[model samples]
Target: MITENQIHSLAKRWEIDQITVMREYLQILFLFYLYAQRKSDKIFFKGGTAIRFLFGSFRFSEDLDFTGTLESDEIIGLFNNACSDLNREIPAVEMENFKKKRNSIVSRIRYTPKPDTYPLGIHLEISIRERPITKAASHIETLLPVSPYPVVTHLESEEIMAEKIRALLKRAKGRDLFDLWYLLTKEVKLNWDMVKKKMEFYNDAATLTDLVSAVKAFNQKKLFDDLAKFLPRAQRKTIPGLKENILEKLGRFAVT
Candidate 1:
């Protein structure tokens, strides 16, 4: 359990706004509860959040994304237990709603610390149908600024980069492009072998040529619009040339 002052202090230290800090705090709390319930072993954390929390990507993520092989009933129990345990620390935390889709579970969580104010919502998406092709190296523990407990398990960086590549080919979101550019700039090598396995699972043919074609067809304007809000004022200057920069960096990976 964290107090409002603690959250504020963390936000100050990070030089980010309080809401962002609070959201991250809630994310940490959820991760703690999930691990405590022994659900961490069942699923491997992935997507932008994983990149941010585990690998130190600067971009902020709005939702928690994961993939695993767990039944609906079991996942629900995990969430129920997590929410119940979380409430002990922060009474305002609640599981607002959860819907079971064919291949995923979309859950809405509300955190409202103040009585008169509206609650902040965070979505947790669990892809139950697909499991990780490349397993994480281990359950690595990470410390956050706001929380004392460490986020226990996260997928490997190479695996995350591979998934980002897959997402770049499949989705038009700018964050995917931005994440790839950031990872590559940091010299994180893509696991081409794992990328092929993930592509096969999605029934998409994986090849350097195919990836290049996808990058060539990406909508630069749409990517800019989708990612504008998330970028800092200084970083926003690069948006005009982001498409070209991303395409250039992506070209390097096409052969290797």
Candidate 2:
């Protein structure tokens, strides 16, 4: 159990804003719960946001991505009806916020500000087709698939999401340096190898290649040097397989 004192110590020691970010995270989870209870006639495609809610970050996600399902049309989407059910001030709001698209990813978001410290926003994206599932790794623990969306699987555990996210941080470093640091410092790491293997299962070549690229940038900026100095004792105890291996890999890929 992470005690309050421990968290405070880690925050001050690591010089990271982990707890403040997590407080914001709980609000996003609330928004996801709003949609998961949907019973609309339209087939809504659910993926990234849901996965993030179930497994990913403890911070506000700027981009919400989704795909419309096998049976869907554009004229009238589920946007309005879902908001109406929730009594949002505006039935819905529309935006063209996606930076770019690859393979029919549709994003729709409506912000309904709550009377709270942090404003609450609702975002929905529908992918018309399902994401191509990577072959399952032996390490991944698969729960019984959700019947509504067989393609959607709860990552057997939180650790699974942590490791994959860590690897992703490395790959996405510098390109979106802020997101990388957020994932590394904020999320809990239970089983890094499982996360690493699960990512490999999804796309081995891309993951490995991106990993090299991300770490190189990390090294150039001495990111891990900062991490090594401040990682909490509890976190140090949990990241089992990746201690020297990850550090060595980071060294090898280090930019110099």
Candidate 3:
């Protein structure tokens, strides 16, 4: 484990809180374990955390989400073994309150580097409903110094964008909106077909009209409320006009 001083330096360099850096370190450790265990091939990493690490998104994530073919028992075992690896690396780390909730293995991962100090917690949600529709891609974990750097598996950027769009329509969370805007800023195009398929899974229709209506109807207050803790202080100022920004981008991108 890196020393507290090194962790602080990293936090300063990244312009985020020291605890967030520590949480990310824990995330890297688990990814390393997955790569080492050769289970990365079966589980595909997605969501905002993947965007932050894989594509350099400015926002941070609170949960590590994945979708794969592994059964709940297998996932629990994987998490237990990963917790062992995390404990070996950082003695203060503990995996607690694990529960299997209908097609998903959810748990809380807490890391306390020392006594009497606040622990950093990350929610782990692994959905085992299905496998990735696209071929898995690999990215080298560069945040921490893990020997033979872990080759993390994830879905293509377009596919991730598709899921984000689906999430926006289904949940309408602020983070999903921010992520969509960020992806657009990076020029990542949406896979319209994939978006339709994902929505269809919920028996919902996906069309430009529905997408526009949803974006227009977004509760500005709710968007900020959901994103309050997730976004950096500076980025929070941009939320007011975010809806218009997304609509403009969609206008250009959605033109058939």
Question: How far is each candidate from the true structure, as Cα RMSD in Å?
Answer: 2.8, 10.6, 2.1
On a 0 to 100 scale, what is the lDDT of residue 160 in model 3? 87
Report the lDDT tens digits of candidate 3 across residue range 73-102: 777787778888878878888898678776
Candidate 3 total steric clashes = 0
Instruction: Provide the TM-score for each candidate, comma-separated.
Output: 0.85, 0.40, 0.90
Instruction: Give the per-residue lDDT digits (tens) of candidate 1, residues 1-256.
Output: 5567887776666656677778877887787787776655777778887777766776766788878667878887887788898888888999967788987898878988789998887788888887766555333244344344545555677778888888888775789888877887777876688888878877885776676676667777787787766555456668778767766876676444
| Better structure of 1 and 3 per TM-score | 3
Regarding lDDT, does 1 or 2 come out ahead? 1
Q: Rate the local accuracy (lDDT) of all candidates.
A: 0.74, 0.37, 0.80
* Residues 56-164 of candidate 2: C-alpha lDDT, one tens digit per residue: 4322243444433334433123434433433432332233343324435444444333444343344445444433222221111111121222232222334333434
Error of 3 at 80 (Å): 1.6
Candidate 1 structure, TM-score to reference: 0.85
**Model 3 TM-score relative to the real fold:** 0.90
Model 2 ranges off by over 4 Å:
1-52, 74-76, 88-102, 112-123, 132-210, 218-256
User: Which pairs of residues collide in model 2?
Assistant: 66-125, 66-126, 66-127, 67-126, 67-127, 68-126, 68-127, 68-128
| Superposition error at 147 for model 2 (Å) | 23
Which numbered prediction scores highest in TM-score against the true structure?
3
